[model samples]
Target: MPEPPDPADPHQPIPHSAPWWRHAVIYQVYPRSFADADGDGIGDLPGVTSRLPYLADLGVDAVWLSPFYVSPMADAGYDVADYRDVDPLFGTLADADELIARAHELGIRVLVDLVPNHTSDEHAWFREALAAGPGSRERARYVFRDGSGPDGSEPPNNWKSVFGGLAWTRVQEADGSPGQWYLHLFDDKQPDLDWRNPEVVEEFHDVLRFWLDRGVDGFRVDVAHSLVKAEGLPDWTVRTGMLGDQGEDGTEDAGEPATTDPRTKELGPMWDQEEVHEIYRGWRRVLEEYNPSGDPDQDRILCAEAWLPSQERTMRYVRPDEMHQAFNFQFLEMSWRAEDVREVVDTSLRAADEVGAPTTWVLSNHDVVRHASRLGLPVGSPRPNGIGAGSEQPNPVLGLRRARAATTLMMALPGSAYVYNGEELGLPDHTALPDRLRQDPAFHRTAGVELGRDGCRVPLPWVADEPSYGFGPGPRSWLPQPLLYGPLAADRQEGVSSSTLELYRTLLRLRREHDLGVGGLHWEGGWGPDVLAFRNAREDGRPVTVVANLGEDLLDLPEGLEVLVASGRLEDGRLPQDTTVWLA
Candidate 1:
């Protein structure tokens, strides 16, 4: 028989979390789908403000709002027309200020989304760039290059947009002639800015001060890794994934392989470059003004939306004077195998330990498939952008079970974690959304070959029986809702003890009390290969072991192990398959 597990802290007193970002749980709120007020069939700042109480009750430390900036909605607010003002579609600038104020009142910090990689084609700067001739000062702020082919008919080189087609979009000259081609890593409506230009560098500093001067706490830097490029704009040597579009503010993980080999990867001319660290170091200075540990409530933070070749490369973004936190895309990509989970966790913690930064873990985000659904698929299935329509359907029941187990496993680790919006309800992707209502540019640009991220961005359901499931007072939601949403609405699960929402609340509360987020984790291998068992021990000697069962066979816990919580109900004295249990 396996040796009995170490004693866990069953009755240890829990304490409050540290300063908002230093060691806390952050929740991602995709503002467009979180809630809709004013009955416009779209979510707004006021709707988010109204839901602050819900977030606080759920026990998250801070809320990261996706872009609500002024935009023409070409790429769903990402094609920003104005960085300093809130678009009327979401609310006014005054509403944004009020939302920040309201969030602070509830002891919840707010981090607004900031898109620095590109601006909407309608932005004043882009307009000026268009009006000016090539080689002019205005055009210098953007990546406008001379075409190589005769009469400049061909693009400058061969670079693809993240949405689709060539990355370069030809423009009409001042004299009404087809002229220079400007680069846009994403949709044609959003042109990539030239960070080498001093004006561009100074402008972002001003934008940073603009939000910091306001009551807002910090920013989730969109496309954090793509701001700078190579010295000579070299051609690609290592190409990964589909062709045509390769830009989504540069967050694509390069479709890395699943092998555990110790090898280095070349991310090419435009990704995870060494020069990006200098830019973040500058942002760190701005963040320092508000990061006084004495006032933990008002601290500031910077979250990098980086998808590097490895978690080790991702850690350089958080090297003390760089960013406070960087998303662990490697962790998010790990398969559901016990050894894969252990490898990513060990590598992540070891990487962060060297940099003296807290290891941050997240399961899902707006641009990716929902973890609940993703987990149900075979461990090594290709997750190319979004699951193309009718490719592979997930087992909803299996997915939810794995998702819950994964969350428990993530939370029990030793660092901060992020919970994507609607994750608490165990919401799966609306895989069957009608093609007509699909709004993601990834879908239309690729002509249905690439389904894009719309399946995960459907408007959330707030009430079971209300119109639009209480998403708004409107008759219908902006995106179609699945029929099962009525059964999983917040109103239906609010007070139910067995609901996923309640499980999240209880887990967070217990996580705080157990001091699990600030410690070191050690794996226990005696329980066999299908089970992942680890101990998170604090300085007080109270170790909490979170064990997740990944196989069909039931795993039995040793006697006298007091169960603090579980992802699913226990079977006799054994932990059910696809379940996680926290024991002392």
Candidate 2:
């Protein structure tokens, strides 16, 4: 639990010792919406390079950029057309190199998104597979199988796509006759790769070297749990196969109820397969090759974006020879309740402790409604994929209060944390986005039953008064920005003490100064059922106590304790409902 050298100070050189990511603050940058240097109505690599200073100033140890690989924009760049090249939509390879270099100069590590489970239909390999016909070696690189049921009209199995429709898509033979079908767990534009193929395995290893050679600190492995399937690709017997009830993120919620142990449930054929561990073990070797000295700063880490049935199942991904971290989705999915929060925190720590890995905490990302808005939804309400003009809206006032409080509590805990861009601005989801402007595949695939993740992917607002709220120099952005963004733009909160942006800056600064990230947690007694109180034991004798009040009633702070920072203003020296405070 020893803390690494203070990354909070950019002037200090990162030593070759202690793995920095163990307790680092990693910021997620959704490239298409982060910033736009060009007036082409889309964000590019140059746009991201121009914003490095902002991230440096935010005090994060690293920035995890979502996919900017060459793509046709189907699935919003998740369908990678080329693993080694930057998309024209983003910029040239030089721009990516410059972005990575500049980020390192500013004392921030850079992580790129890697989607290994599948590739775009336009990828060179997939295209060759299509042209090479049914039994070619190129076709063997992907999951190509003959369909069943007389004349092969029906899919081989009942597997459903996460987006919508059947998981298998039929293709016409070179002679214009009906041919074999291909498997795609997500959109049809993204075809799943057959990891069993030696070529497929070797190809990704080369891709890893390409980026590692280019100076990327690590990779955030997307859909890491689904790379390998059941040995025979059996049909799922559960009520909810692949297209389970939509999660808040517009993806499948395969997790069982929190009250029950998800391990008790039978593992789905399409997810958390046993074979996925072997793939990551090989990846670990690739990462280790770059860090021969085992220097923490030089270590290339892998964080799995796995949505497994339980923390215990998820822990397998971060075993000693596997990934370095896995997203703490249980905490992200939990409602705003003391019991729920405590249970997730306790169980997550216990599970990760067993494997000697750090627990990664995340509240929001590009796929889900921002926590600011989701926290406002009434308890027990159905989680919508996106909030449209006619959808039920969240209370902005209440949402921001809880969001700030939740963030404060999250930062004060042990282990690492991930901050999605725009969360610092206290931005809520664009709930009123018009249907005509929606573009997430989840929206169109489900025939609009699910609003999709477009609300959260809206471009960020940088300047309060400029065109497109300063997201770009142009008058318009790819996705329309709501007028409300103007008030919450970065400029408006720059130095405002009460603003969420300033609050985040202070928290990050103090988190490093107090050595809270690597510190140990000691639960404090006497707190009520609706309150969570714990002491973070710092290296110094001065320990920091974090108290979050989720109850409706105000809580009185104990005498002799100094209030350092608070999520919201205290009412008459008492903690207000849905507020969090740090005291010494």
Best prediction by lDDT: 2
lDDT of 2 by residue, 1-584 (tens): 98643322111112223478878999999999999998887988899999889988889999999999999988999999999999998999999999999999999999999999999999999999989998899999999899999899888877777776678999998899999999998889999999888788889999999999999999999988887877778875342222224433334354443122244566567777787788889999999999999877788999998776589988999999999999998888887889889888878877887788888999999888899998888854545567888877898999999999999999987788999999999999999998988998878887897788989988999999999999999987999988999999999999999999999999998888777777767777898999999888755568888999999999999889999899999999999999999999
Which ten contiguous residues of candidate 2 have the minimum total lDDT?
7-16
lDDT of 1 by residue, 219-316 (tens): 89887888777776765523322221233322333344411111344565666678778888888887677655647566678889876667787888
Cα shift from native, residue 241, model 1 (Å): 6.5
The runs of at least 3 residues in candidate 2 whose Cα sits more than 4 Å from the true structure, single-residue gaps closed, are: 1-17, 237-264
Local accuracy by lDDT, each model = 0.81, 0.85
Q: Any runs in candidate 1 off by more than 4 Å, and if so which? A: 1-19, 237-264, 291-297
Q: Compute the lDDT of residue 120 as modeled in candidate 2.
A: 98
Cα-based RMSD of candidate 2 = 4.8
**TM-scores for all predictions:** 0.93, 0.94
